[model samples]
Target: MPTSRPNILWISTHDINPHLGCYTGIWPGAEQASTPRLDALAADGLLFEQAFAAAPVCGPSRSAIITGCFPPAIGTMHMRTRATPPPEVRLLPEYFRAAGYWTGNTAFTDFQVDVPEPMYDELGDHTHWRLRDDPEQPFFMAFHSLITHESQIYLSDEEFAARTPDAQRVQKADVPPYHPDTEVYRTSWRRYLELISQMDHWVGTILDQLEEDGLADNTIVVFWSDHGLGMPRGKRWATELGFREPLIVRWPERIAPGSTYAEPVALMDLAPTMLAMCGLDVPGHMHGEVILGPDGRVQGRSEYVVSARDRMGEAEDTSRSIRDRRFRYTRHLHPDRSPMGHTEYPDNLWTWKELRRLFAQEAQQQLAFGEPPSILTDLQRSIVAASKRAPEELYDVRNDPHEEHNLAGLPGYADVQERLDSALDTWLAEVGDLGTRPERDLLARWRPDGRRPRAAEPEVDNRDGLVALTGTTDGSTIGWTTDPPTADRRRWQLYTAPFTPSAPIWVKTWRLGHEPSADVPIAAPAR
Candidate 1:
């Protein structure tokens, strides 16, 4: 391992399942994937075979990644709603900045909480580690790729042709049994695969830039996706396909080349793992435990990974999933509603329309994935029908990797169900499962009378030639800019330490959930 601190580069993608070229035979239904850059990356780095997201939806999943806490535990289980987190909790970047490292995020989105001001040294499309004033200082640079996002799966034909000319050859064999063979679905799936290829190109460009800047060798490159594929039963559901994520970490000094780890790992562990790699203390409040360090993988890592789902758009439901090595068990709290209950957002998807069509055909004794008389499989019916969902589902992932068969009802897996059920009960109690508290109650607490609490205005004091700024607000971070502030609020610098100002500066105090105080100006001290 290197003696000095290593720069960490985090690259996150959206709505992707493990269909990489490297996983050709390993992960079924992705044998045709062509990804040279990612293949090379896997050859030179550590590829985690069983990485899963804390939540299936993008917003809630991202909330878990940024906070290093499960959505249910942190009051961020809802899909797109914003709520206040506990005061003691801090975003991942804050830890890097506090450790005297330059932090930059090319694209920043923490949908769980309303972050009043930019916390990183740089944020936005042009943000980069090179922008840091001190070249010697270590950095944590993060960025995201939207090429493989949900919306891209059903691009306009003209747009799709521009990106992928050969995107219409997908067949029934390429798709799982859950989906019926249809032209619209075939096209959407083809486009999704091609986008994954393009996303690899995007990743290559960033890595190329890192090497061009001579930071590759000393930098730890971590690549991951927020969640899995964005099909009908993919992104929002708590199924195996929905929660699976691709994780690759390349740090040649410490991580062995071409190595692979098959242990189940949650995306929430990312923040603490990064901190551990950087030799920093992992905060006690974080729900994730560090999984890797200088000595490689942690001993006695977590046995099971848990995920959550709640109120996706207008769809109202709550479900929790627990996965051990060979099985995944899902318990739907609201069994009255079908797992296929419509959410306006995903209902627009072509695949969702296809699923609905299949559901109607099956009702008329017409739909089939394989051949005539096969009819709709139980998995397909469960996914597309408006019928009530089973209270619980258990899948033997080792035997049925697609999770088509539910073992919860079967008598043989009694021990498995009991063990997983107990584990889930224990976890819920330990975390206090803030999700049990009504979202309305949480909203009321976060925003009284539908208005955010405001932080006290920041005050600046001149100590000799140094400028010291503070606000009476108990726990607030400050953001400052010059008199003629730039239109882009992201340019505001965080006030972490006293500074000798070159010109007059403006400052404001901001807490996570509170409204930032009005900008107050401070004159430059005498030279």
Candidate 2:
């Protein structure tokens, strides 16, 4: 039981859409997805019907979530890059910890270009609040269930067959119209839903532990996904399928059970909202708004939620989009680059392979018939489109949820296009898209030499019975351990404040996206 502050548990799943039973008919046939635990959880919680991620992929989406700033604003937009966030960007956990909350991550999931220091008091595959030294202390815990990640879908067909049960397997998969209907594609979809079911089980395990420990009533449990499904035209695109995701929160003390909030919200809004809920001042630099908090809902649809799809691995490109209730507007900055089909990572999935296969076969037939074929959809060929057809797009989501028809140049919609287009422009001007600058230029600035920079040596002094440590480099932090070498603590404990050790302690210095300093010993206060 917590004394004053409420505990926060963030449950994040990777690469999924709102495909649970609680989201009934959000996607046709999603009711059959079989997530009993999540369904029950939502039944007793608040379900957000229109939540969108800032990015379509994990690294960028998670970056925005942890930083409370759009990745583009902080130079962490591109996927899996080595860019460092500017110093003074306080992470959400740091604020909680400063307020005397014990933060823990059951396993690591930050794929942002920048990493936070003093990340967690405890971290491991099985780490839990139960393992904390003090049970009464309120805690911020995160559990990322990776069973639903796209990589799992890359398993061999035989492995999927062996792992799946007949009852749970997808039959006649409700294939998205953009994708071709084929046995191979259906199998891949089947495997994905099965994985979601497995992820639901993981959720049950964590929630069960919380209740088992008598912390259920006071803890706020939030379940969300990094992005939408990993299929083609989904994870790497800026369409609704790629950006919209599920967000459900169960706060027994604060929430009205079985209620739903349908206003649009950006996933990044979560960081600032969590801070406000904990009674901390939200940093002004954060781009997200306080949509929900202790006081009550900050009602109204977000004017527009901006999203981005930047370079993923070797396939480099950029696209920006903005979505309001009924319209989605997008601009592709680099259509000449290779299509998402050529992206190295997701290309391994059978769905991607199916797109390429179906597109090529249809192309051969088109050449023979001397006419364009309707069999291969623009959505499917978008995987391997020689280049994007238009630099901009507009979709009326309420009318065409799948975004099959592009309304950018169509007649009689100039007001809608101009309004959204202006809103997106204003947002970019205010925040400044760092992603527009060439990635190589950013790399050179961060690393003049071929190597990553190292944190300056840490200096420590024992003055007036209080030991203090400082770092020369900006954004640097210290990690120290009182334990000896025989104990493999794996990593050192984060040094947030000066403390009198029982004896001497070892310390190392680290700066985000830079090498850590060498370990050195510091003595305790004199008796």
Whose lDDT is greatest here?
Answer: 1
| lDDT scores in order | 0.81, 0.80
**Residue 517's lDDT in candidate 1:** 89
Give a tens-digit lDDT track for model 1, residues 168-209: 233333667767667776777777888888888888888999
lDDT of 2 by residue, 388-507 (tens): 567888998878878888899777888999999999999999988988898988888778896778888788877765777888789777777876656766445677788777777788
TM-score of each: 0.93, 0.93
- The segments of candidate 2 whose C-alpha lies over 4 angstroms from its true place after superposition are 1-3, 27-29, 113-117, 161-167, 296-301, 484-487
| Least well predicted 10-residue stretch by lDDT in candidate 2 | 160-169
Worst lDDT 10-window in candidate 1: 164-173
**Native-vs-model 2 lDDT?**
0.80
**Which stretches of candidate 1 lie above 4 Å from their native place?**
108-110, 116-118, 165-173, 295-299, 365-375, 459-462, 465-475, 483-490
The alpha-carbon lDDT assigned to residue 83 of candidate 1 equals 65
Task: Judge candidate 1 at residue 307 and give its lDDT.
Answer: 92
